[model samples]
Target: MLTIGVLQMTSGVDPEANLAVIEDAAKRCAKRGALMLFTPEMSLLLDRDRARARAWIESDAPDRVIESLSVIAAKQHLDIVVGSIPVAAGGGKWANRTHYFHPDLGPPVTYDKTHMFDVDLASGESWRESNAYEPGREVVTVEDTPLGRLGLTICYDLRFPALFGALGDRRCDAIAVPAAFTRPTGAAHWHVMLRARAIEAQAFVIAAAQVGRHEDGRETYGHSLVVDPWGEVLLDMGGDAPGLGFCDIDLGRIREVRAQVPALANRREIAKS
Candidate 1:
């Protein structure tokens, strides 16, 4: 069984403050014998003001948030996944990227968020992420860990099915979904969407999330989750509080479930009319 820790947080615009909390949590996870720690989206900062965000976010040097965790991972000999960081993507834009770090690895594995949360809600919450960030054109997945192959994806990507399907096809044992979900949408769709993904892919789904209100006055619905291949929620960390959640997984379950169902192999392309 692979032991994993999911860290739920409510971050602000200050990178230092966020790092303080995350670094401590990483140590705890390491001490508890967790093989890896997964964090939520925008693990560094979540600033609402575009000007302030651009002024504070950087691309010229390594992000302090990721750097600190990288050092911790090496020091403690742990593995970590920072859900997403808003790094300067040139031309006054940013890329919401995920970083997977290992104690022995030189550089953290990266996955820029592919789907942007561009929507207008009926409850007066409107976001235009494209205004400040550029979308990633490629999909990324890694397959060399104790937990078997795993696919990495950020918040908005959860709503899209095709991405998860493609990962399922690749025989991933688990999928990482880290998010900073808005309160309204999360309350309505969070649990269902997460369970659906696990059921559809027949893979373990691990999601760490941001919760509560931030310095920007925006609120997020937080319920960090871990689902088994049978789509049963093994863990659900409650809303808005910072803490660590654990799940002990057997990777062999993925193969057993797939063997009985065999959905991926049964899939066929549709014929054009």
Candidate 2:
């Protein structure tokens, strides 16, 4: 069994303040005996003000948040997945990137979010993520972690089954889907989709989410969750507030579920008509 920590946050516009929260969470997670900690998307900064955010977005220099997290990971002897942060992707566009920091690993492994959240909700919230961010093309997975093989994904990437299918094909034991979901869509789809993904992939799904009202005039659905390969919810930190939660993941459950269903083995390629 692997004990993991999930940090649900109401991140604001200040990177310094957000970093402070993460630092404290790392210490708490270490004290709680968690081998790894997962945080929400935009854990560093969640500002709609592009002009103000650009100063912190990494271009020519390394991101300060990532650097700090690396040091913290080593100091705490904990692995941390900083859900997603903005980094310059060249061509004047930034990428929503996930960074995995291991205590022994010299540099973190990274994954850029593949799907963009560009939609007009019934609640009058419209996001044009592609306007400022570039989408990633590669599916990323990490090996030899406390949880065994783990897949990396961010918020909008949850909606794309093909991405999860790829992770399933890779036989990842657990998948990290850190998110900053809007209240309306999250209320309607969050739990159901996470459960479905766990069922389909036959892998544990760990989603640390952003919650509550933010300093940037936005509200997110909290409910940070951990679902087992059997589609059972191991933990759910409800929508009320930002906090840290822990779940014990049984690696043996993956084998047991796969033995019953064998869905991944049954998969076949479809030919275009």
Q: Write candidate 1's Cα lDDT for 1-273 as tens digits.
A: 878999999889888888877788888987889998889998888788888777677644346656777898888777888898888887868899999888885688889888888899989999999888888877788768657787999999999999999888887888999999998899999999999999888999999999988899999999999998878999999994878888898888888888888888898877889
Tally clashing residue pairs in candidate 1: 0
What is the alpha-carbon lDDT for the whole of candidate 1?
A: 0.87
Q: What clash pairs does model 2 have?
A: none
Quote the lDDT for 142 in model 2. 95
> Weakest 10 consecutive residues, lDDT, candidate 1?
58-67
**Model 2, residue 107: displacement in angstroms?**
1.0
Computed on alpha carbons, the lDDT of every model, listed in order, comes to 0.87, 0.92
